[model samples]
Target: MNELLTKLSECIEFGKINMASPYPPNMKGQEGADEITRKALEEGVNPQDILSLGLMPGMERIGVKFRENKVFVPQVLMSAKAMSTAMLHLKPHFLSGAAKQKGTFIIGTVLGDLHDIGKNLVGMMVEGNGYKVIDLGTDVNSEKFIDAAKENPDAVIGLSALLTTTMVNMEKIARDIKEAVPGTLVTIGGAPVNNDFCARIGADHYSPDPQGVVEFLNTKFA
Candidate 1:
């Protein structure tokens, strides 16, 4: 709500990484998320406020834009970059218990699926929304997902698959997690996936875009 936090939010929304990055011409040469976040910390702004008030709003805006088709992958990736740059300063606070995360989210592309753009975007958006993301990367198997769930009992598991062939893997993984760790939440998404597929696979939730995932998690944790 303050000036510095407002500027930080604007920088994140506009994809301004620093004073030198020129991806968004209107914000060129202006102090960006990196600088403003660091300065905010130096000036004693609460790190939680920087995240909740500054970064989350920016990410939420772009997320809504993405869902409405007002923005595309490249633009969303840029905002994610700015968010990541700013998070560098806040990570320490999160680590030291000075700031709190909403929950843990374990995500991966189902086995035999090498695509990551969708998974990565979801992870970034979830992280921006205050969840700690444990990315298992692409081509992940059921055992790995089960192991992660076992370790983080309360964490939500997210499965992604771009290929229709690989989408079947999600069903197996979801069943594996439910059998191994009952009550664990599993959400699925990708080009070939839909709400019907999610229901068929016994997964808990499904969404077409990253924002939908964020909203699902928020409701789960709310």
Candidate 2:
């Protein structure tokens, strides 16, 4: 069972989506995350174990690799796809209360930002790390974020901006959320955002990469 879990983690880390996926030349035709996760479940492995041992480790490895420039966006996206394939099998267990999540995360690409790649990457990374992510898609305004936070009171909010112009929107949204809902932690990220910007805008944190965001969430929840 441990062997299968290890193999499942390898499948995710290597971007093997299924037996037929051909992106990673060396891993061709091997049982990928999609198949291995189902097999592990059928073999009576606990869903939480598969999540923590198989999925999270793989994602962490890729996240670090991404931070180190060992891989790029296309590769990371493929790995995330592989991880999502495995997650589909575990999600029901999560919803049924048989498997536990670390916490809820509400995320958005603040209003005026149409770009979603960064937002999606962060969402997938957060989800892969065992947090339930509520992605309020691109051009998301403060009201939408507040509404989602109200529904999931303990959820941490992540605001992303790809453009310098959009960064101001993030500051506004953060202010609105804090004023309306005290104690709500707002984290910001983007190419243009930094710790100084975060502090100036009253945001709780700023991470340049998805892994940094995941680490912040882990510390906050822990």
Candidate 3:
């Protein structure tokens, strides 16, 4: 069972979605995350154990690789795809209340920023790490964020921006959230953002990558 879990993690980390998948060339034609996850459940492995031992660890490894530049966007996207495939099995357990999530994460790309790849990546990573992610998609304004926060009071918020001009909207949204919900934790990210800008705007955190956001959430919620 442990061996199956380990193999599942490897499949997800390396982007092997299934037996016929040719990705990562070396892993082609082997049982991938899709097959291995089903096998684990059939073998009577606990869903929680499979999630903690298989999927989450694999995502954490790929996330660290991304942070260190050992991997790039395409690789991470593939990994996220594999992870999402595995999550299909786990989602039922989560919804049935047999599994509990760590927390809630509300995320969006700030207004005027139609870019969603970065925001989507962060949301996927956070969700893979056991948080329920409420994605607001791209071009979200302060009021939408505020409304989501009101709907999920304990949720942490994340903001994404891809352009220098659009980063100003992130600042405005952050300010609005903070003003309306005094203790809300707001995190900012994207190509044009930095720790300095986050501080200047009174946001709670700044991360350069999806992994950085995961780490910040872990630390704060730990």
Which stretches in model 2 have alpha-carbon errors above 4 Å? none
What number of clashing residue pairs does each candidate have, in the order they appear?
Answer: 0, 0, 0
Pairs clashing in candidate 1?
A: none
Candidate 1 on 144-163: residue-level lDDT in tens? Answer: 99999999979999999999
lDDT of 3 at 49: 88
lDDT of 2 by residue, 111-169 (tens): 99999899899998899888999999999999999999899998999999999998889
Question: Each prediction's Cα lDDT score?
Answer: 0.92, 0.92, 0.90
Candidate 3 structure quality by residue, lDDT tens digits, 1-222 = 499999988887888888887898999779888888999888888888888889888999999998899998899888888888988888898899877778899999999989999899899889877788999999999999999999999789999999999988888999999999889999999999898998999998999999888899988777
Better of 2 and 3 by lDDT: 2
Error of 3 at 30 (Å): 0.8
